[model samples]
Target chain A: MADEAEIFSQLKQAVMEGDEDVAVAAAQAAVAAGVDPQRAIIEGLAAGMAEMGRLYEREECYVPELLVSSEALYAGLGVLRPLVIASGKAEKKGVAVIGVVQGDIHDIGKNLVKMMLEVNGIEVHDLGRDVDMERFITATQETQADLLCLSALMTTTMIAIKDYMPAFKTQLPGVKIMVGGAPLNQQLADEWGADGYGENAVEAARVAVRLLETK
Target chain B: MHRDHSVKGKWVKCDQMTSQERWEALVNRRPTDRVPCLQFMLGHTAVVNGRPIAKIYDDGAESLACQRNAMALYGHDGLIMHGWANAGGAEFGGEIEFPYRKYTGAPLMKKNPVQSEEDAWDLRVPDDILSVGTMPIALEFSRLQYEAGLTVTLQVGSPLTWAGSVYGEERLMIWMLKKPELVHHVLRVITDFIRRKADYWIDRFGAERLMAFDLGIETNKLYSPKQFETFGFPYLREIHDHLTERGTAIILSHICGEQNKNLPLWARLSYGKRGMVSVGKEVAISKAREMFPDCVIMGNVDPVTVQEGTPEQVRMLCRACIEEGKDHPGGFALMTGCEVPPQAPPVNVDQMVKACRELGRY
Candidate 1:
């Protein structure tokens, strides 16, 4: 009998490889074999992605690697999300809304944050890219998400976050906002008056989840 | 002299205002009545504007006429002269895909072409400026920009990124770590190639009409800042040095990524102290004012905003840009963070230039 750790590893590998078929089977197999789905996702798939993040931060990988990891994690979630939601066993970490900001189409980073969230057991409502401030505000309200994440690849679009957050707080007071991307930083984040900022997708996920705890 | 807002002004005529006089005023932190212009137009944007990629790559009178027709019809300032945006990497054999632009009918992107270290080795820097497929087309276009008496800058990839396109990003990082000499060797060749190309354009356009060099890629901070001291900074310095020897006046270094951490090490690109540094939007020009307080700072328009936004939004951006960035004599130029998006609405761009004109001088 394969231990939970062993089955989890297989699931992690499947997710990282972007093999949705293998990921589903591996995840389903783990559950049927008496393994905890939450542990499998967090310690198994999420851990693998977390390691990939560490590697990426250290420059062990590049954009393609980051992209592949995101794709893989999502592939695994395509299976795990349903099983956990159906059994009422899905994570109660917190609900979060995330997407890339308007005028920018790059979403690899956005997708990676989603994977990290799902693996950490947070229910996520993704609005996709080219989203304006209104969409962010509306999504936060409709989903009643505890956290909102915005990503921008260009500095010009990144400033739009400054505009969005103020408007968001006007209606949804104290709703924390986090922003990240190639052209943004902690200073710009501060200047823009964001609640938080991250340099990469993994850091974004970690900070977002951390914010959720305080909320 | 106060000039009215008219696109009909002889901007390209002999009696027209001297570029140095106008450009100097904008960069010197002096508020001009008319907005001085600077941009980073990617080949992708031109293609995406509904012009066919084939025509953009076609080095012929008809193709040039087509591209000119597209840009001129849009009332753009004029295309910058240079090599294909992907010329360096594609010629060196990087994996790339062409995203079809809805408006321009041109293929818009190419990426991830190189997959390994051997792939990097296989990259051969061209001996001639027009060595790549669309390179001649690029040259012709650049010549046309000069012919129209517009400011034309030739944008090229940085050594590391040009290498990344050939060796794959993974190998690029590893090579920097493990085979420093080998990678630097390849970088030198590419640098030499770029220098040769820059000289070729200068020979054709005359240094006065020539704008600057665009090395838009992640450098040391994105990797190791020391690598910048070794590879990115020095290699770039080589280009600037070469241009300086020829008495060229402008050099814009564009690196877009999580690269703010490495700004202090880029002393060679210092502004006001010696020369000008056009930091991309990735590095906040506002923050850079404090960081490299003496350096000339240009840039940070969002390509996507210009591409997909309403004209009003673009005008708002233009205003915010001038307001946010610090200025001095020769300290700033209005440009995008990286390459301008090909699909950017023509009218939005018009609004941006209009916004600049409203703020700048004669």
Candidate 2:
């Protein structure tokens, strides 16, 4: 007997609290009540994730909390995505190809970025870690992505960013390239000809959206 | 390849102080001719020695040669004998893959041993796990460094870090929330393994001769202060107490990434008083010195600058680090924030030593 706004608020609370069962229940309730799937996602799940991002930025929550909240968000999405697709309301904001550069197997940062981007309605094609340069180009060309994001944890692995920037510029002329990781700074990103630099997952998502807008 | 040890550049061999004497003076907060400069340059050493990364990591002779060659090249006061940090997990039944190139950095954990929380129960510290995998390489390298009269610090990964490698970071993170008891159980197993290994090393090298019980996890970046207090602090305290009871003089801890928020928690531990904490590039050395007024502080220099920047830039930064901590009541040593990259310019390292000699004098 809950109203539509009540159901949406429940979904949002479930996500913020990282309760997967409650999130799925709320999503189902929204669907059963004839509430719009897009509204359920944007106003409920995505809104909760945006709040989580703010909490992360303020250091109120850390990686564990962010990760669990993301899991809960995905649980809600699992139920709502099909519904949204069926209703023709599941429009991806932008397409992005992401990976950690070659010689680097540290993918946790990249994984976080991917989740953040997906939660923000960007379609992400993850290439995993230790990805070769050619594989990045292939993924970008195949997906016709709007942006390419690369991550590297070590200075040695980060050299790949500088080495391959020109090649990516020529090969995927239309795609914007963004690089990030512990060892990288904005200066290094600019020096490597990267179009953008994201200090963390939240910023990476924002950068992806901005890149698509500019494109 | 033997080079004469003479007064070169600004670095003069102080005949009055042996390497141990220099280090002891610095640790005891006594004045010395110069502050000791320890180089964590194993990756750079392997590349300069022309050894394959895998061979250098797995073969004792190759690792020793690389360490010795690096000391001769950089003229550092001490050598770090860390063949690879992932070797502990490999010895604990995790599958690891090392790239074939000369400077590919650390080996990868191809397959973790613990697939689920239940699998953690199956993991047991083998009776001779230390001698089985690349650990023997580290032991032999340490033995060689000890015999050569060089100060040697054997680097070991902390329990949570070893467990993460064995169970994967994502799964470990999930377990920390969902199955914390399992995470604690796995940590207990890893702690036992580490204690046994440390005991063996202490028995062989003698506690005083072993420079310090150096533990690295880069835990700060991964866990919040609360989570670290729950999962990381207990094991760290256990290891610290175990080693201290065995007459280990100093315990050095390295935590990578921004650790400004976790410094107070680290300072509160009992063994933290007699130890040195190496913070990453994001931490300001001056602030760390101000915060931990009673502890010896060791680093905050950007490793990337040493790897890619000019020698002059490296020298300037090294000098600035020395200037920041020159007058702290707790002692300071000049070192890279993290491990030096394999491709870090030798000239930059030379400049680091030169800067320490010039600006680090008490």
List, residue by residue over A1-215, the lDDT tens digit for candidate 1.
Answer: 67887888887776555455777677778778877677777777777777777776787665555555566676666666667678886657788889888655556567777877776667889998778878888999999888888888653466567667778778777677888886577877787777888877768878888888888
Report how far residue B245 has shifted in candidate 2, in Å. Answer: 0.6
Q: Where is the poorest 10-residue window by lDDT in model 1 chain A?
A: A61-70
| Candidate chain B TM-scores, in order | 0.73, 0.88
**How far off is residue B250 in model 1, in Å?**
2.7
lDDT of 1 by residue, B245-287 (tens): 7655555565564577567656545321135456655577676
Model 2 lDDT tens row, B32-58: 666667766766787788766665666
- iRMSD per prediction, in order: 7.7, 2.0
Runs in model 1 lying further than 4 Å from the true structure: A1-200, A203-215, B1-33, B42-50, B53-79, B83-87, B94-113, B126-129, B145-152, B174-185, B202-209, B219-231, B270-276, B289-296, B307-313, B324-327
For model 1, give the interface RMSD. 7.7
Tell me the spans in candidate 2 whose CA falls farther than 4 Å from its real position.
B1-21, B24-30, B83-87, B101-103, B218-220, B270-274, B291-294
Per-residue lDDT of model 2, residues A1-215, tens digit only: 67888988898899888899999999999988888888899889988988888988888887778778888999999999888888876788889999999888888889889988988889899999988889999999999999999999878789889888988999999899999998898999988899999988899889888888888
Please name the candidate that would achieve the greatest lDDT relative to the true structure: 2
Q: Candidates' DockQ values?
A: 0.07, 0.55
